[model samples]
Target: MSEQESQFLLILFGGIFFAFLMSLFVVAMVILHRQRQVKNRQKLEQIKSEYEKTLLNVENEIHQETLAQIGRELHDNIGQLLSLTKLSLNSAKPEKQQQAKEYVNQVIKEVRALSKTLNLDWVESLSLDEFINQQLHRIQATGFCETSLQSDHSFAELKKEEKLVLIRVIQECLNNAIKHADPSRIDIRIHQNGKVRILQIADDGRGFDTSQKSSGSGMYNLGKRMETIGGKFQLSSIVGKGTVVNLELPFSV
Candidate 1:
C-alpha cells in the first residue's frame, strides 16, 4: 500500500477499536446496575419477611396473655359470685331471692365481657389511648398504686401489631414497677406532635441506674420490638427521683 493509504487504514482501525471498547464499557455498566437492583430487591424481601414473622409472634403472645387473664378472672371473681348466688337462692326469703337474681345478672355481664376477650378482635378495636387508660385502671383497682392517664385523645393510627407490642411492653413496665419500684403513683401520658406520637410511662418509684448493663433481656427485647415497628424506646431513671419510659412512633400522615 502507499504511505497515505497505510496511514488512513491505521486511523480507521484505531477508531473501530475505540468504539468497541466503549460498547464493552456500556455493557458492563448495565450488568452491574442490574446486579445491584437484584441485591436490593432481595434485601427488601428479607426485611419484609422478618417484619411479618415478628408481627405473628407479637399476636400470639398477646392472645396467650389474654387467655391467662381470663382464667384468673373466672377463678377469682366469677367463681365467688356464683357461690354467693347459690347461697342467696337457697335462703328462700323474698329479699334473698331478689339478691340472687341480681347476682345472676352480674355474672352474666362478667361472662360476656370475658367472652369478648377470647376473640382477638378487641385488640384491633382498642385505640392506644383507650388501652393505656384500661391498663391504668387495672393498676388502680389493685390499690397498689395511684394511676392516671393524661391524653389529648387525638392519637395517630397504628397497626394492630404495633399496638399489641406497645401494650405488652407497657404491661411489663407496670409489672416491674409493682414488683420492684414500690411507687405510690404511676402516670401515663400520650401526645401527638405533627407526625410523631409519644407515650410516656412514668413512676414515682425507686429508680435504677440506666448506665449499668441490665442483667435481664427485658429492656433489650423491648427496644428491639419498638425498632421493628419503626419506633424508639428510651428509659431514663435516677436513684431517688423516678423512672420514665418514653416510646415514640413516627409516621407519615
Candidate 2:
C-alpha cells in the first residue's frame, strides 16, 4: 500500500477505537446512575418502615388512653345513674311503684347499652380469639355476609400489637372478600403451634387473577402491618379456586 493510504487507515482505526471507548464510558456511567437510584429507593423503604413502626406505636398508646377514658366514664356516670335509679325505686310507695319501676328499667337499659364500652379496651383484656370474635359479631350485625372465626386457645397469648394488626388485617380481608369476591361465606382460622401463630381467611366466591391485582392498598397495608411485627403475609388465588390470605407470626408479644 502507499505511505499516505497506510497513514489514513491508521488514523481511521484510532478514531473508531476512541469512539468505542467513549461508548463504554457512557454505558458505565448509566449503569452507575441506575445503581445509585436503586440504593436510594432501598434507603427510602427502610425509612418508611421505621416511620410506620413509630406511627403504630403512637396509635396504640392513643387507643389505650381513649379506652381508659371511656371505661372511667362508663363506671362513673352510667354506673352511678343506675345505682341511684335503683335506690330511688326502693323508696317509692306501692301506688307509685309501677311508674318508678318503669323509669328505673329504662335507665338500666340505657346503662347496659353504654356498657358496650368493653369494645374500647377489648384488646387489653381479651384474647385474640375474643377480640376477633367481637369484631366478627359486629360485622355480622350488619347482615351483609356470613362471617365465622375459628381459633385456638393459645391465640390469646399473642402480643397485643400483633393481635391488633391481625384483627385489622382480618377486617380488611373480609372487606375485600365482600367487595371484590362477592363471597357468601367468609371463614377465618387462627391457631398457635408453640410460638408460631398462623392465621388464614378464605372465602368461597368468584376468584380473581392475583398476579394482576397485587397493588391493592388493603393487601399492601396488611402485609406491611405483618412485616412490622416480623410476621409473613402471603396471598394466593386461582380464577376459580377463590382467594386465601395467609399469615404466620412467630414471635410472642
Candidate 3:
C-alpha cells in the first residue's frame, strides 16, 4: 500500500474509535441519571413509610388517652352517682319511692349513652362517617358545643390505613376547634366527587387570621398528615367570623 493510503486509513480508524468512545460515554451518563432517579424514589418511599408508622403510633396514643379519661369519669363521677341513686331508691319511703324510681331510670339512661363512648371497637367496625358522627355526638353530649354531621356518601370504600389517617385528621381538627375556637356550633360535611372524597369542617367560632404565622404545630402537622396519604388540606379563617377546613382525598377502587 502507498504511504498516503496508509495514512488515510489510520486517520479514518482513529475517528471511528473516538466516536465509539463518545457514544459509550453518553450511555454511561444516561445510566447514571436513571440510577439516581431510582435512588431518589426509593428514599422518598422510605420516608413515607416511616411517617405513616409514626402517625399510627400517635393515633394509638390518642386512643389510650381517651380511654383513660373515660375510665376516670366512670370511676369518679358516673359510678358515684349511680351508687347514690341505688342507695336512695332502696331506702326511700313510699311517698318518695316514685321520684326515686324516676331518678334511677334517668341514671340508667345516662349510663347507656356513655356506654357507646366506651366501645373502642367502633374504630374498626364503623365506617368513617359513622365514626365521625359518633365523635361529634360525644362532643354534644358533653354540652360543650352543638355538633352536626352531614354526608352525601359513605366512606366504606376507604382502606383501613386510609381510614386511620382520616380519623386522626378529623380528631385533630375537632380538638383544635374545641380548644381554641370556642365555637358554639361545629358542622362536618362529607361528600364525594368522582374518585375524590371531600371533608369540610366548619365552626362558627371566633376565628383567627390565617395569614399570620402561629407558634402552634397543629395546622402544620395536619397538613403533613394529609400529604402523607396523598391528600390535600386547606384552611380558611376570618377573624371574628369562623374557620373552615377542607380535606380532599383520592380514592382508589
Query: Which candidate number has the best TM-score?
Result: 1
TM-score of each: 0.91, 0.56, 0.78
Q: Give the TM-score of candidate 1.
A: 0.91
Q: Give candidate 2 regions above 4 Å deviation.
A: 1-120, 193-195, 213-215
- The worst-scoring run of ten residues by lDDT in candidate 1 lies at 152-161
User: All candidates' lDDT scores?
Assistant: 0.87, 0.73, 0.83
What's model 3's lDDT at 251? 80
Candidate 1 error regions (>4 Å): none
TM-score of 3: 0.78
lDDT of 1 by residue, 52-86 (tens): 88778877878888998899899989999999999
lDDT of 3 at 170: 88
* lDDT string, candidate 2, 225-250, tens digits: 78877888998888867888888888
Taking every candidate in turn, the Cα RMSD to the unseen true structure, in Å, is 1.9, 9.7, 4.2
